[model samples]
Target: MKKIGIGICIGIMCFSSFFSYGNEQVLPHHHQIQKGSASYIETINQEKNRYVNYGDGYMIDYPSHMEVDTSLEAVRTLIKDQEREIEIYYDNFHNTPNSAPAYKNYSNAFIKNTKDHIKEYENTATINGMKVHLLKWSRKKLSKVSNDKNFYVSAEIVKNDKEVYTIFIKSSRQFYNFEDYMDVISSFKIIEKKGNPSINTKFKPVERKLNEETKEFYYKYFVNSDKLRWGIFEQSAPASFSYLKGIENRLDYEFKFLVRYQSLDVPMPLEELKNAYNNNRYVELTLQTMHMNEENESITYDILDGKYDDYFEEYAKKIKEFNHPILFRLNNEMNGDWCVYSSYYSSKDTNLYKEVWKYIYHVFEKNGVDNVLWVWNPHDLSFPNFKWNHYLTYYPGDEYVDIIGLTGYNTGNYYPGEIWRSFEEVYPHVYNEYMDIFEQPFMITEFGSNEIGGDKVKWIHEMFDYMYMHPFKNIKVAIWWNGIDWDPLRNPARIYRLDNREDVMDTFRQRLKDYK
Candidate 1:
């Protein structure tokens, strides 16, 4: 993903050569070089050039030697030298969904519009406080022009609330000096709009007591369950709602879990949460504090070291207002290397993770948010070369946690050298290990298997059978992750959706009915 940006930059140059004109070519209306405009020319001739404001919401600095192009639509500006070129464009399509989906549409359009083969694409780069999606490919024109000289290209796309901006940098992979152009691209900045809402710092602590209905539901469904409560997690809210409606009609059982993700610094969607509660579902909120970059850990110890007390308090107050029992999985899968709170990124300081957990739990308690059932979740111990081996160390003690949660998956050859594993093989070892240490009821917070290397129907049957017949009988909740694992613009993994698979759905429906 990181390398794709660099590759696309060079590949675009081949396409550029066809459209680009020589120095003698007449300039466009916007970029006309006026005669006797010494001041403007002088500005462009300086070693460290002055910032060019595009009259849009962006400004950037370029080298004195480069030429700026202004003819292209959605392209804010373009700068080019002999060996390298950079193009900046912005999209304000009101009809498009979120940044991620818009990015996918743009990537597909680029491939279709320009006949270039995108070898790699990744949304991994973060620049100017915004996440950037990158695409890389080799130009088809280069193959026709010269067999010996292959042109590679890369593009970096950044999205804000209003618009999506792309920085297309093209250079010769062999001869271009990347460091020189990178400095110019890094200087790009977005002008702040007026009247942007500021983060609420004042802690408006609410004094709302827990609803008796919420307490009754929690006690009945979670604390003393006759059989495992079933649920499904889809990518979007509408999809999840539709899936639940369909499954409920077919199976004659209502879903008990509504799995949702809460990103860092973003407030919980109170309206959506309320709607889920109205539907009589328990929200399994996975509080994600980290961004995608594992190396660039955002949630540091200092930030969690009592600095955001007001923020946490306000968040707790909001949860209290919801007044529904939620399974709050804070920093879930802490033992895994993917999360920022994990010991792998925290200098192997599992104690810091525990401290952060305790701090958040304390804030919720302080704000009278007793409806939250704190779930201490960690990934299963089956992952190879797992850094945090002692899962007990990550625990914030038995008092803070109301339920022990585990995330186990039958990847089934999702990655190279990955073998198909049965349900028992994926989770039994970790379940037994945790059972020996914690007395709290267990929940498989996230569980699914792929139909790639093995039979998903058989795997689902095995999972249900094990849960029904297991002697421990403490595992009371299981949430199936129903989503597409393999997307064209991103990496591929396990596909866990069972709704479309009638065989699997029938087996699941029967198992739900048969389970005692």
Candidate 2:
């Protein structure tokens, strides 16, 4: 829940198979990996393993099996025992300044991290007149056993006068075939549209250590779960648990997490965090980098320049002290204009945004603050809403994010120019867009229908109706924002509370039966 400017998956709709869950046909996120199905992995010596993607301009002939988990992001994964995934992604990156910092020690998917995470094994070659950077890394989980295997990652970056295309191939050590990456990577060909557009490749492994919060138990649990986890942010604090109890009574269910907001200008709000956790609730903290409305031209850039090092370090330490896992959303809704950290305030350069994001994550990493899962979120709607200001343009890349946060509020017809929007109008398209690009589970970090525009009760029913009709395979959590936004004249304008009326609350409770 944000004051104003806040925003928030390979959403792989992979290869799917429907199985009977009691009276219903259900499709879980982790379907059994098989050949010829949507989890299409080519079988060795099988022609079917070879898949060509005509959407972006590329084609490939993979070995053995093909695994396409369209539910979360990769185009395909490989073989029966072990797995390999191929993803062809296009970054609107012909405009990126040569000066911006990206994920992992200032390098993105195309460049190497060169840090303590992935062991660096780089290969740079000159092909004809083109300088191609082929970054290859073999990352092994550091264990004492000498026979332990490692996964391999390789990628290519190609750009013309338009889009920057990245070809990434990853080999899972589900079984050790060290040369697995070469089988598929060598066969990738970019179908040229113009006379001669260039193509290049590079990739490094993405690895991080957490303080006992294994990715298996936390992230994958959400990714594989079929149930929806509900949450909320009531307007009051300290007494928020009291309000949450009342909200639970109204909704007839318990919340998975309680949302909390904090500004980075202060030390971490350890007290508020403890307050939430003490009530036996998990916490999702949306940490804004600036003191509201005080962010100037230099704030985020100064963060890039190391202005708040001591503050952030102390903050990270406090979070580590909290011990429990937290859904950490930093500078969320970053693509929106209302946020101080958005590119709108930074010379319209989003690289500054990514750099600051990477900077803060590295701080947490350096401090061994591993109980937090990083959420990369952009608002469902952009404020300026230009191509340059698009949500994908602000992505820091996949390696740093564990969850994708979705925030789209039906602000209702409260303020001027705000119109009545159906529940259908708010989510489906935005959720689909993220599914095409990211391989992370999504959470509606905060959203609610205002009572002003139309029937809030009908809106609730429609929200659940759309869910039953279309399975949102990657969405694991949905948090309602139970609060109000005051108008300029200081009146309660957007009444988003679900408990205001008996009918509205009853509608949410009734319709929520199937989803939760």
Candidate 3:
């Protein structure tokens, strides 16, 4: 983790008051405010402070005056003032099934390791909606050359089912202000847990079309058949095609090629399309219209304002002129927070997102781009902040969509303190949830897992097994994200290719043979 300097001045004085609970005291911050209360309104207004996402399932608000260092291997986050320091540690403990035991073991280890005298300690305390163990201790200077000096420490240990977060704050006794630091501690909250639904809705059906070649391919592999169509995505079409040639040579099978076009800056790569067509391979084109630089904010206003009409019209003309059957997936993974069109920034207004989708589809249709097989994609609704009912609301109607595409990944511990999940655990819920609503063929537009923290070979093998045994019998296309996940911010980049790991590659080849 590298240290990125971000300045933000947060005025906490407005909500600096505290409330007592039993023997403990807690801050009346954003998390504590009631929905319609005055404090909630004030908190919302004052939420302009910078937030640091740990990517490990949690995020926290830090004041601008503090320097944050996330580069430490052991500590997830390091926040420092002139002399006062805060260290956040993300610990992975596999055997512990519950929080109580995990907290006790970690607390004992911390006390022993630091050689500190415990002035006060509480085995249980509630902070930021999590049950934590609190410890306040002090250590005196033992150096013979040094005069009498004392250092104060306040620590909180928060344990989840799979991980533990230890937040340690240290300062000289003269500078130690427990209340001020407590405000920072209370700002921490877990952001990656499964979403809790407040409502449910039926899945809306969409009508779509496929070209002659695409229809034949779908029938042969997916419709009324158990055979799976294998696909791969690389950074470039040439790279993907090269990888496909290697796979075909190894397994004696050809694969569908997946290509992605992002932002308004880059037009469709005609060379890539020509290469795929010339090589007798089908292409799955993912058209990402969202702005490349912006992911956190909503672009709904731009879409509704028709600011990109000329861009869409030109793209639509190109698609029509190309005159080849391609699986056109527009704005895939729209339900996930990583996209600008997601409900997170759209104020949970799915209708606005759907309008944008419909507008894009209408542009293509108006341009007579009939060769495109429209694929409507959304991230699995089980992800945090995604509501199940909201998933259906993003539908651009059956007339605009042809197939349902879903994206899922076994991310492992890519983020600090994240759990290593299996393929089955990450994808099945979405399939089960949507299968009954829409009577259309399914396609996994993106799927892969990190090699670290879990068995990638076993994960791949199980993915094929699950696909073969899947009850809906609608899943036709499964594409593996073959490129290296080179995001510098995330730990353990998820490499999901069959080229390097012989065991995993052999498993994939053998599984494809079995499917055949």
Top model by lDDT, which number?
2
* TM-scores, all models, native as reference: 0.56, 0.61, 0.58
- What is the C-alpha local distance difference test score of candidate 2? 0.61
Q: Candidate 1 has what TM-score?
A: 0.56
RMSD of candidates 1 onward, in order: 21.7, 14.9, 16.9
lDDT of 2 at 134: 52
Better of 1 and 3 by TM-score: 3
Is candidate 1 or 2 superior in TM-score? 2
Badly placed stretches (over 4 Å) of model 2 are 1-207, 214-221, 237-239, 293-295
Model 3 residue 460 lDDT score: 83
**For residues 235-345, what per-residue lDDT tens digits would candidate 2 score against the true structure?**
565346776787777777877677778786567778887887787677778888887556354566566656688898898899889877788999899888778788666
lDDT tens string, model 3, 36-118?
A: 11111112224323233323455455554565543321224456666566665555546634354544453444344233344
Q: Which ten residues in a row have the lowest lDDT in candidate 3?
A: 32-41
Give the Cα-based TM-score of candidate 2 against the true structure: 0.61
* Cα lDDT listed for each candidate: 0.59, 0.61, 0.59
